[model samples]
Target: MNGSIKWINGSATLSPIKFIAKIDNRLYDLNHFDRDDFNEEVLELDNLELALNLSVSLYTPISFLELSNIAKIVDDNNLDYKKVDIFALRDIRTDKNFNTILNINNFPESIRKYLTLKTLPLKSIELITTFSKSLQDFLNGFFISNISISYQKAKIFIDNIAIQKEALEGVKYIDGFEFADRKTSTHIEIDNALIAINSKIFPMSISTDDNFESGKLKISFYVDKVNSYDKFIDILNSNDKDIRTLIEFLKGHDLGL
Candidate 1:
C-alpha cells in the first residue's frame, strides 16, 4: 500500500476541442481525496478533434514548482492544428502501490454479484466508466485515506517523416539525397549519461528522467486506433525495460544483449 505503481497510461479524446491548464498529481490514501483542491480545466470548442495519449513513470514526489513549470512551458508554446499524432514513453514513480489496489477483484464480493449471470474471467471484468465516478467508487470501496503524486517523467515521439524530410531538404549545407530513404536516429546525452536512445527502425522519440540513474526503466509504443489501453497494458505487463536492464535480462537468458 506504500509503494509505487510503476506506471500508469491514460488518454483523453474530445470531439469539440478542449484545453488543459493544470494537472492534479496528488496521491491519496484510502478514504481521503482532495477533490476541492484539485485544479483541472476543460472547455468545449468547435474547431477540432483532439486526443491525448499519456504514460507516466514516477520516481519521487513531484513538487508544486515542477508542475507549475510544466504548465508554463505548455502555455508558452504556440501549438497549431495538424493531423500529426504523438507517441510518447514515460517513467514514473509513486509513494504507494495505488495501481495494485485499483483492481475490481479487490472487491470480489461486489464483482461476483455484478456479474452473476456471466462467467467471464476476473481479468476481463474491466471498469471503463467515467473517470471521476470510477475513481471515487474505487477510493470509497478500498478505504483509501490519502494519495500523493510523486515524480513523473515522459518522452514523446513524433512521427513526422514527411515533415522531417522536407526540413532536411531546405538545409543548403546538407545534401537531402544523403538522407533519402535512409533511417536516421538522434541520441540525447546529459552529463555523459545516455538519456534518450532513438532509432529510425522503431521510429519514436524516446526520453527518460533522472530515474534513469537507477536500474528501473519503462518504454512505450503508440498505436493509431482508439481505446488502446488494453494494448498498452499488454505491452507494459510484458517484456519491457530500460536499456541497461533490458540488455542484462536478455544476456541472462542466453540471448545476446
Candidate 2:
C-alpha cells in the first residue's frame, strides 16, 4: 500500500486553505484504519461513519527560507522564486484539521469477507475499482498497495475440488489415465483446474494462497494481468451493465453476473 495520488488546486472554486500555526486536538483522536478484522474468520472494512481527518500542506516560498534569512524574503521582493519548490528550513506541515464522511449507504455483510469469498475475482476487482474512485474524490489524493502480476507459476493453491473432480470424473487426459482411474494422488486441485477467467478487457487468474488453511476459503489475485489502477477501473466501468453490477456489488446484495 505505497502509492499516493498527487492533486493540486486547479479550480478557482476550490479555496486554498490558509496556513495554521496550531492544529485542533480533535484531529488526533480520529484513527486512520482502512481495514478492520473481527477475529480470524470474520473480516470487515472500517470507517462506516467515515471520520477521516485529512491533513493539509501548502508549498510556498515563505516556508522554504531559513530562520536566519526569514526576514530577507519578506523584506526583499527580488529574491529568486525558483527555490519555492524546495524546503530549505522550517517545516510548515499541519496536522489533521478536519474529518469528512461520505454517503456510501448500507452494505450488507462484511465487505472484507465478500471480496475473497471464492468468486472468480470479479468481486475484488469491483471493490478496488470503486474504492479508488471514492478515495480519490474524498481526499485530494489517496494511497494503496500496488497489485502486480506474478508469473512464477501458472497454478496456485486450491481447496475442496469435489465439485470439479466430479464434473471431470470420467474425463480423459493427454497421458491416458482417467480422472477417477488414477491410482495415486493426482493433485488436480493445485496443478490443473478450470478457475482462470479470461476476458477481452482484463485477463485475470484467481487462486487461493497456500499460507492459509485449506479449510478456510480465500481468494488471491497474485497473478493479475491488469497492470495499472486506471486500467482496472476502466475495465470494470467499460459498460453500463458492468457499472450497474459494480454498484450492486458494493451494496453487498447483488447475486452477481
Candidate 3:
C-alpha cells in the first residue's frame, strides 16, 4: 500500500494536513511510509509541523545520497519547518547498519536548522556509547528507577583461618558463614565450621590469597543462629552456586536463627 499519514484522537481522525502560513507552520503525520518507499520524495516537508505515529523502521533504508539532497532542499528553500517528529525510527534494531546512516545523515547543518526531530524508543547502551559520547553523558545524568549490578567471578583462595577471624571480628553475630569472593564452578567448601569458629578467637595463623578474577562477584552472608547454616549451604549447593543467593537466603532468615 502507498504510505499515508493521518491523525487520530480517541475514535476520531483529524484533518490530515493543517498549515499555518503566517508562522510557516504545518502539521501532519509522517509515519505512513514503508521501508521500500523511503526516499528523497519524503523530504518535501519544508514548511510544516509534522507529527509521526510510526516507529523507527522508516529511516532504515535511507541512504547518504538521499540525505544530502534533502539537506540541499531544506537549505535552498530556507524552510522554517520546525518540530519534525521522526518517532517512527525507533522500531529499527540497534545492531543494524541503518543506525549509522541515520546519525550521520540527520546532523547536516541545513537539515538540522529547519527540523527539530524526535526519535522513538531511543538507542541502546552499546549504540549510544559507540555513536555519540554526548548521548552517554546525557544518559548518565538521567536518573533511573532501577539499577543493575553485575558481579565478577574469580577463583579466590581463602585462608580458612583468616576468614574465621574476619567473620568473628568484622561481623557482629556469627550464625552462619559464607565466602562471597569464591568462584562458582570450584568445588571448595569449609570442611570444619567449628574449627574455623574456634580459630576466630586466636591470632591469624592461616595465610591465603584473597584476590579473585572473574566476571561475577560473590556476596555470602551469615544467617541467624536459629536457622541451620548447613541447610542453607545445601540449598545453595543445589542452585547455581552464586554467593548472592546465600546472602539473600540469610537475609530472609531474620529470626536470629
Candidate 4:
C-alpha cells in the first residue's frame, strides 16, 4: 500500500506529507505502525495541546512588555515566520503577574517603578525585618498599601512581627496585613487572642497550624494585593483597647480566639 499522508491545514491551503519517510536510501512503510508507534509520537503532540489548553485556562493574559519581549526574541532568533497571529502570539505569552509572589528579597524594582508611576494596585508589602536599611527603603518606595509578615520560625517570628508593626507605625500608605506561622504542632487557639490583638495593629491574618499544614499560605500575595479584599487593614488601624476587648470577648465565648 502507498504511504499514509497527513494533511495540515494552513491559512489558505492544506499541505499533505507522508506520515513516515525513507532514510539512508531505504524504503519505509508508514501504515503498518502499531499502537506503540502512535503512543511514542502522536500521543505526545495531543498531550502537549491538552497541556497548553490547561495553561491558558489557568493564567490570565500577558502584559504588553512581555509581548514586546517575545517579539524581540523571535526577531533575534531569526524565527521561520516573519509574523504570527495576534491571538496565537498572545496565547504564547504567559501572564507574569498570575500567582506572583512579591517577597522582600524577590520584589522586582522595574515592576515597582511601573506600578508606582502608574498609581496601580499591583504592589504589596513583604514585611521582613531581617532586611538592610537600603532594601527597606527600596521596598517602601513602591507605595504599597498592604504588607504580609511571615511568622515562620517559632522563636523570632512574633518578635519580627512586633518590629514590623513598630516600623510601620503611622505609615498611612500601607494598610493591609497578613502573617504566617509555620509551626504545626502549636494550636492557634492558644495564641489566637494575641494574634487577633496584633491583627488590630495592621490589616492581617494569622495563618498558623492548620493553614501551614494545608499549604494554603503560599508565598504569593499578588492576588490579595490587587483585589483589595483586605479588611484586616482597617482592623489593624482600629483602637488597640477596642481590639483587645473584642479579642477578650471572643476568647470568653471560646470561638476562634
Each model's backbone clash number: 26, 2, 23, 7
Candidate 4: C-alpha lDDT: 0.35
> What TM-score would each prediction reach against the true structure?
0.15, 0.17, 0.20, 0.18
| RMSD of each candidate relative to the true structure | 26.1, 25.7, 19.1, 19.6
Instruction: Order candidates by lDDT, high to low.
Output: 4, 3, 1, 2
Per-residue lDDT tens digits for candidate 1, residues 1-257, read 12112121122122232223122332221111112333433422222212111211121222222222222222333222121112111111221211211333233333223322223321222321112333324322322221121111000001122224344332332212232333322112221223333342133323444434443334556666763657656544442454455446434533222
**CA lDDT of each prediction against the hidden true structure:** 0.28, 0.25, 0.30, 0.35
Worst ten-residue run, lDDT, model 2? Answer: 95-104
By TM-score, who's the top model here? 3
lDDT per residue (tens digit) for residues 54-145 in model 4:
32232334333333333443344353222333325433322332212112123344433332233222222223334454444434543343
lDDT of 2 by residue, 118-222 (tens): 221322222332333332222111111111212111011111122233443333323222234332333343223223122323343333355224432232223
Q: For model 3, how does the per-residue alpha-carbon lDDT over 84-126 read when each residue is reduced to its tens digit?
A: 2221232332224333423533443322221122121223211
lDDT of 3: 0.30
Model 2 residue 137 lDDT? 25
User: Where's the lowest-lDDT run of ten residues in candidate 4?
Assistant: 5-14
